[model samples]
Target: MSLDSWAVPSNTGSMELTDTTPVHLIHVDPDVNMARFYGIELQPTLFGEVSVLRTWGRIGTNGQAMMVTYDDEAQAADALHELERQKRRRGYVPAGT
Candidate 1:
């Protein structure tokens, strides 16, 4: 898939300076969350293939989002559909009204 399509509003919010260190805030996309539930890690391969990466724990959290790299647009679309299915099964609702 083209990077343009995947590009969306940064889930991570604006950064802020803290008393001692700088803090970076982030937001999690529901679709990405669902992918994690299915044990899929979207990463780019050396050959420029965007596929699922194998991992032990969840790849993303509440604020941070995970990205899935695909070899082509078709694969990306399929992966997205799978994520949606998982989300539906888990009864997950998107953030905001």
Candidate 2:
């Protein structure tokens, strides 16, 4: 079994990472814009700095990307959790059944 199979694909185009524990991605496209949140580990060459990448753009158009690096995974996860909470409050849901 592969990790991909465990993901829940939301109509919003972001995959919910089920295979990987504590990993999450959320993308929500409201009427006028698109917002995304992601949390992941840093590459070894980067000295294991975790990061949260966020993005916002005009719906159906291009947007900007922002990456915030953390000294450790715990901090990154907290950031991810906070953003996820905000998205959920705004009614973002995982797509697939």
Candidate 1 local lDDT, 1-97, one digit each (tens): 7898677765432221111111122234666553332233344445645554322224354333456676654585467556645655665433242
lDDT of 2 at 10: 45
lDDT computed for candidate 1: 0.43
TM-score of each: 0.34, 0.50
Colliding residue pairs in candidate 2: 9-96, 10-95
Highest-scoring model, lDDT: 2
Residue 36, candidate 1: how far off, in angstroms? Answer: 14
Task: Kindly list the per-residue Cα lDDT of model 2 for residues 7-95, writing each as its tens digit.
Answer: 96546412222223443345666675665544332221145455566655443444566678777666766777777677667655543
After superposing candidate 2, which stretches have Cα over 4 Å from the reference?
1-45, 95-97
Off by over 4 Å in 1: 1-62, 94-97
Against the reference, the lDDT scores of all candidates come to: 0.43, 0.54
